[model samples]
Every structure is written in structure tokens, then in C-alpha cells.
Target chain A: MPRASLSPGAVVGLALRIVDEEGPDALTLSAVAGRAGVATPSLYKHVRGLAELRGLVSGRVLAELTEIAAEAVLGRSGDDALRALMDGWRSYAARHPHRYSVLVQAPLPETAEAGDRLVGVMLAALRAYGLEGSAAIHAVRCLRAVTHGFAVLEAEGAFRLAEDLDESYALLAHMVVSGLRTAREMSAADSTPGR
Target chain B: MPRASLSPGAVVGLALRIVDEEGPDALTLSAVAGRAGVATPSLYKHVRGLAELRGLVSGRVLAELTEIAAEAVLGRSGDDALRALMDGWRSYAARHPHRYSVLVQAPLPETAEAGDRLVGVMLAALRAYGLEGSAAIHAVRCLRAVTHGFAVLEAEGAFRLAEDLDESYALLAHMVVSGLRTAREMSAADSTPGR
Candidate 1:
């Protein structure tokens, strides 16, 4: 693991590993360098500092999440797509709780391109329900709020009940799908002629 | 401000103020003591240390949130109670973003009476929908996830679009109410004799 052998992507990959294994609090330049078998200074050659390293990690994770979500919803739409997307998100968070925590805590990249791409996938899924612009954004935010919130709470072991989480999650997904449909119907009713 | 005069409640209150003003990261025991005009070591008489102080703060805040939510839904039922409870939660989070952050980050106390009370308030509100048992827990979890997630994301400036957030929130509330009704209807249908 010579400095010449270490690329920016390699450094970030190691940093992601650190976060995944030891939690976000353990992700420091020294820790990453130690794990990667490179000098701390050599790590700086790839990332300016911890802030930039965190940004890179966040961006990378967001992109990966976007890809997973996109693949889940491929050739699917409406409730099917929503369920697939949400289940994918929950699975990703469960598998990499620390990395997911980083995504929630770290600010999106300055350009926000990665975030936008993630949102784009969501908007595309919402298209099945004929929502766009602000309506779709509202629905997307609602969906994100519930799924992200549930995943974070679950990671924190906040749900103390004895019931199976998978069953609980299914029920949550049902509510979201039902809720989106209801919102669409309301919007349609508001646009129609008076009775 | 003297150690002899400082009560545990007073120390916890001052700690809350520190969290509210400067974010949870700044909530050191020394910071709380300095703000209260007491010596750091003397503050320990009131709180064991940072961990206990955080637990006390979390328990206190959760109790406060439960009170606010309970009051909001008093004499209300169904959609009215749901709307009031969610709005109350949103407002509390908005007014004290850092404190809300601590609520999310800090682990609930071992006794968890405060946390259970909060859930009790949620269940009472859902009673209007004729939901009980696991269904009610699932619904309560759904409500918590969406409202908590929305508040956290909003505090992080994740909602960057120009749309009126109040309007979006209103739409979300509408969706949740409608969804709950729909779920109720579906549950009733499944239990009926007809196909």
C-alpha cells in the first residue's frame, strides 16, 4: 500500500470500510490510513481532509443507493415500484448501518448531483401515480421520511416490541402505498368539476 | 448559580438550553456548568456525568414531547387528533432543532417510562381509527417515522425546493389520514363474510 498505489477512490473505499465496521465516529484520517497501510499524509494526497473525505463517502454511498433503488424499480411502477425501492433502502441501511448513518448525518455534496440523481429515481417511481413537480416532490419527501425514519429508528433499536420487524415493515409499506394513492385521488378530486 | 443551590432539575434544564443553543455536539458537562455559573465538578452532584446528563435530558425532553402531543389531541379524535399531534410534533422540532436532534441521538432511559408515555399518546390518537394491537403499533410507528424523519430532514436543510413547506405538510397530513381510513376499510372488508 504505497502512496503511489493508493488512489482517491481507494482511500474513500477504505474510509467507507472504517465507517461500516466501527461506526461513523471511528472514521478518521489516521484510522483510514492505518487500515489502508498508507501514511496519513499520503491519504491527504487523495482527500484534502476529514470533511472532504466524509463528503466523498457520502457521495459514493448516495450513488450506490441510487443504483440499488433504480435497479429495484426497473420495469416496475406504482405500488410495486414503491415497495421495491423502499425495501431496497431498508435492506441497504440494515446491512450497512454505520454507512447509512453517515448518509443521514453528512451533508449532501455541494453540487448535489448525487442527491438529485437519487431524487430523480424517486420521481420516476412516482410518475406511475401521475404526480409531478411539487406534488411528486411532496410525495417523495413523505416516502423518504417514513422509510428513512423507520430505518434509522430500527438501527437505533428504538422499536422495542416483540413483533417481527419484517411484518411491521410490510405494514408500513402498505400505509405508504395507500397514502400515495389517497393523495393522488385527492389531487384529482380537487381538479374536477364541482358536484 | 451556586453548587449548593443547583438542583438536578435545574442542571438538566440548563443542559437542555445548551443543546438548544449550540447543538448536541457542544453539550459537554463543562459547557452546561459554565452556562449555569457553577463549577464543573459541582455539577456532578446533579448529574453523574455526560452520559447520565444526556439520559436525563432525553427523558425530560421525551416527557415534554409526550405532554405537548397529549394536550394537542385532547377531546379530539380521528383525523383531527392525528393532524394536531403531527403538527405539534413538527412545531416542537422546528423550535428546538438541536434539542430534537439530541432526542433522536440519545438512547432512551433504562426505565423508558417517558418513551412509553409518548407511545401511549400516539396509541390514544389512533384509537379513533378503531386500530388496536399490532395494527395500532404499526400505525404509530408509521406516524412517528414520517413526522420524525420530516423534522430531521427539514432541520438539515434537505428540503431545498421553494415550495411552501406548510402546504406540503398539509398534503402529507391529508395522505396519512386518508391512508389510515383506507387501511381500516380494508381490514373491515377482510373480516366480513362476503368475498
Candidate 2:
């Protein structure tokens, strides 16, 4: 009965710990209850089910990502801001590989409010670089895809080369910055009349 | 018992069908056995187990991706080849969203022959544009990350924007091409020094 005292936050926190120690497959409502020393029904008092529990974890992860991205963009502008934000994301992912995977796993519309906050952070980081309108959105999507894809693969240990992955990541960051600058120039030129 | 006549390829094919219809979570040894019209033990004759079966499926997906990238790059070079290869990958992802996730999920060893083949395809595509050595490797990785990340998020319905994702994808492709070009140039310039 004392197990009923466990709060939703405690349950979710325990779920994350399990995931950190055992990977995503190890996460389940029953497992979380057991870890929390509570019955599955007791967990229902705070969380909906496994799906909701996972969603809760996802919300936390996204929020954390937003914080990190926002911090990375603080007092920085242009390419420097972009790099700092992206590097911050990469650092978070490297540190909490499993939790980050949850963020990437499925798109949670239920957590849209939290997710949007993260998106706002990401967009604001890009804004410091002067990208706006469709170009800004496009740049954000492109930047996200590249950063996340690289992070996921790296987490999965997909890189085969004996070379330092850090080296590759630095190159990736440089490429994204250069890519944004080039896209900015190209779009600018496209909008202008022929020389 | 008569289903004992099925080959590993047939079993894998049927398993892929289940993945297509129901996604990976629906995949189980019992389910595969039932779907294939064989007793679960009979499945052992063709595949090792659930993990092995999944591995087979994952390998098939990776090989298919390699083939598609190859087809896209054939007779193409530079931005054209890059776009073609990425478009080919996107088309495949769209057609086989579930399998695409599977390919990205299972991490393969870099030293493995299959891993080499996958990288070989992408690198060959890059070589068409004069991207060589680490620069070529970095370009291949950048292209892969953006294309893959975009496709997965698209598949997961991550975007809530009003605009068509196709337009977003097109822009993403443009960004990747421009990014790769810029990265290659920077690498070349960095290596050249005295310029």
C-alpha cells in the first residue's frame, strides 16, 4: 500500500533509469511498477498506461532538449549560434543515448505542447542566423534530419571507420554551417534578377 | 507440416509482409509461424529465431537501400548524382516505411562485408563529384543522415505544418547537395592551405 505513495514523476523517472541501464526494450508499465514497488493498477492513478508513460518520458526528454538548445543559442548569433545549438543537442544525445532515442522513436502529438516548445527553441536558434519564412522552416528541418540521423547512427555504433567519430562530427557541424550560408546566398540570388 | 517446404527466403518474404501490414511490434515468432502456415519449430529450419529473423529482414532492407542508391547514382555525378541517390533512398523509404525503420534500427558492424557494401555505394556516388578521402566519407555521412532523418520523421508523421512534406523534402535535398558541395570545397581548401 505504501507503494501507492509513488508519484507519476517518480514512476517516469524510474522508467528512464531502467531504459538507461537496459535500453528501450526493457521499459514497460509492469517493469516500472515493479521498479517503483507498486502494483500496475497503482501506476494507473498517475499515468494512463505504457503508451502514456512512454509519452511522459518523451515529453521530459523533449523539454530537456529544448533547454539545452536554448542555452546553446544564448548570447550567440549566426553560424556560431547554430553550431552551439547543434553541438549542445549532440552532447545531450551522447550523454543520454537511450532517453534521446525515445525522443526520436515516435512523433507524439499528445505531447505537442512540449514538443512545440522544443521546436520553438530550435527555430529560435536558427533565427539568430537570419533565416526566416519557408527558408527558415526548411533549414530547421534539414538541420534536424542531419543532426538526428548522425546522432542515431552514432549511438547505434554504425560508424565503421577506424577514424575518430569526433572528427566526423566536427566536419558535420562545419558542413551544416557552410550549407546554411550557401543556401542563404543561393536563395538571395534566386530572389534577385539576373546579373 | 506441408509448409515445411518453404525456404528461408519465403519465410523472410512472409515476415516482411507482416512488417508491412502491421509494423515491427506485431512481429513475433508465433506470429511469423502462423502467417507462414508453419509450426513455430518449423521456422527454425529456415531462420534461427526472432532476433535472427529480424536480422535477416534488416539485412534485406540495407541491401535494398544499397541497390536503390546504386541505381540512382548510375551515370550521374556531382549534385545530380547526390540528388538522384538521395531521391532513390527517399522513394524506397516512402514505399517501405516499416522496413526503412528496421534498417535504421539494427546496427551493423562497419567491418562487416555488408556494411562495406552499403558504404561503397554511397562513397561511389560521392566520388562522382570529386569528394575523396575523409571529405568523401563526411559527405556520404551527411547525405545519409539528412535523407534518413527526414524520411523517418516523415514516416512517423512528425511534422504538423500546413505545407506539403514533398516540398519540404525537395528543399532538404537541395540543402544536402549544397551542403555537400560546400563541405567538399572547404575540405579541399583546408587541405590546399596557401590559398
The C-alpha stretches of model 1 lying farther than 4 A from their native spots are: A1-4, A38-42, A108-111, A184-195, B1-4, B108-111, B184-195
TM-scores of all candidate predictions against the true structure: 0.88, 0.90
Lowest-sum lDDT 10-residue window in model 1 chain A: A103-112
Q: Per-residue lDDT tens digits of candidate 2, residues A74-134? A: 9988877887887898889889888777776654676678877877877887876676677
Report every candidate's CA lDDT: 0.82, 0.77
Clashes of each: 0, 0
- Over the stretch B100-144, how does candidate 1's per-residue lDDT look in tens digits? 877766754542778888989999999978986788887888787
DockQ of each: 0.52, 0.52
Alpha-carbon shift of residue A20 in model 2 (angstroms): 0.8
Q: List the residue pairs that clash in candidate 2.
A: none
True contacts kept of each: 0.43, 0.46
